[model samples]
Target: MIRALVLALCGLATAATAQDTAEAALRAVQQLEAASISLQEAGSGRDRISALTETVQAYEAGMAAMRDGLRRAAIRERTLTRDLNTQSDEVAQLLGVLQRMGQAPTPLLLLHPSGPTGTARSGMMLADVTPGLQAKVDVLRAQLEEVAILRQLQGDALATLEQGLAGAQEARTALSEAVSDRTDLPRRFSDDPVKTALLLASTETLAAFASSLAEIEAETGAPPAPDATALKGQLALPVDGTVLRGFGDADAAGIERPGIVIATAPRALVTAPAAATIRYSGPLLDYGNVLILEPAQDVLWVLAGLAQVFGEIGQVLPEGAPVGLMGGDLSDAQAILTESRQGAASTRPESLYLEVRDGQGAVDPATWFAYD
Candidate 1:
């Protein structure tokens, strides 16, 4: 009886934990479904871009939740299976005892070797023990049901995960197209190709190149730079990522730079941190695709290492507008699930380099961006 009670309690606890995780996964799936609907119903052009962005974000979040829940369910299933296997003999003995007591004739069941007083005492003992045994049986039944449900949930979740992956991919494609087709954003000035080429050829380093941006002649009647003094220290990060290297932090080679490196997920979206005019947007030297934004006079925000860049040079972008996407191919649902099952760390592997320039030199980006 004591063993039965212990088994029952352990099984109940396991079931409860698994149920909570399963419910969370279900909620994530519901969120993904809603996001998908929003994307499908979105209007064309700029509106579609916003909807698609939300859909991709939703899919990413849902996939993360599903991965965690499935991992927990798998662990719980293994634990319950091992426990049941090791305690099989004890469980069988318990069942046999109950069965024999139920099958015994009434006369034999009432007749005790020590006569009427012993029989009455025996009946009282049976009354107390019966309820406990019944409770253990009930718990065991519930545990079995929970295991079955978990198995079914895992089996069904794979299809939903695959759908989410496909939806995210489609949304990303649509967003890229919408951004390309967009022509409504206001331009601060037109880029001077001849002057920019000369400046790039003469500069030896990023610092030198940034310091020479003022030499690039803007189109006539260009608007003055936006005032960003009030926005200092309140700007959002351009991408969702963790800081891999702080401003002035040395890397593996013991070389340091005046910028921070952010670790991000593959193909993650990058957005403008604040309303800014694009001073430059394209590949520059060995920095891969680079984007330089001027939000205020003498202040430049340099972003590098992107797979793609959006918006034309000299165009003014509103805060949170899509800038580009990080490099690397997006992992499929199966690959992500397999990694999660193995208890791998974060999937964020791409890096974005950010440098802030104020006046004639670089400044620590932490002073202007609220990453923490």
Candidate 2:
């Protein structure tokens, strides 16, 4: 009986040892998984930090560039003003001389009731000045043309400076918001990976791509944005500049398009005219990068001629939020293309083409946008 009791105690001891070993192994595995999860989180955090750093650097560089551009524009403006004033005085004097000559023609002067001596004297004076006067008149004409061109250039420069300053301010605000957030927002809509790949590969043209994108978006509806119809004629403009072309204005090709073209500063920021949801944001043919915003169920706003675009399809944007930036002066290739198509070259670097469309057809945006 003593031997049996000892054997039973030994068996219990073995069982306890086995249970402790199992528990220890399970804990080891759990610890490894936890460490792996922590490593993954660390990696993601680092990547986000890097991205934010890049964004901040870019904003700073943009601000510096805008300041330099403004300074240069101001100097040019002053010089043009001085030159124009000088040219204006010269032109006025030339005009007065021409007016006097016209009033007293040689024939009328020769018939002066004074005498032959008076006629000879007048003829001699006219002869002496005629050659030099004609030359001066030609010079004045050229100077006047130059002055007009300079005035136009100065106007454009001032406009560009204004737009650049506004864009820089907006960029700073956006950067501040991004820095405050630890996580970055997704840049675009998250579609099924396989379907998106297939659709992208199959698309042959911009139109086809747009159609496919529409179908995909229909399958996954977008979040609602604020309606903008009620704010018509009260909404602010997307950029700072003058309207280069009004809605329905005829192009060089004699085609009256349904959109307005705003001539803005080079690399100027384009903003949302009103609260809206992005429908599409990317390059589309000759339009360059474009952003399509849906301000209401039936209303769509299309902004084209962007050098770079921000945000993504299906993203909600508040009024005055930056959407993209206007392109710089045309490249050599672009210049060639423009000349070939229009038979003329343009000096304007950036032009934002804005089109508003409803369920029926294209609509004028001027009525919806504030001039100021």
- Highest lDDT scorer: 1
Clashes in each model (backbone N, CA, C under 3 Å)? 0, 0
Compared with the true structure, all predictions reach lDDT values of 0.76, 0.57
Q: In lDDT terms, how accurate is model 1? A: 0.76
Please write out the lDDT profile of model 2 over residues 205-239, one tens digit for every residue. 54455445544443245344468889988887787
Per-residue CA lDDT of candidate 1, range 1-372, in tens? 112222222333344374554554455456556656776787756666666666665555555555566666666766676777787897899999989988999799998999999999999999999899889888778767777866665555555567666766776787788889988777877877887788788878998888888556556787766767689998878988899999999999998989999998888888888889998998898899999998888899999999989888889887777889898987775775576456465478899999999998899998889986
Local distance difference test, candidate 2: 0.57
Q: Which stretches of candidate 1 lie over 4 Å from their true place?
A: 1-44, 75-92, 102-107, 214-218
- Among the numbered candidates, top TM-score falls to 1
Tell me each candidate's TM-score.
0.80, 0.46
Model 1, residue 125: distance off in Å is 2.7
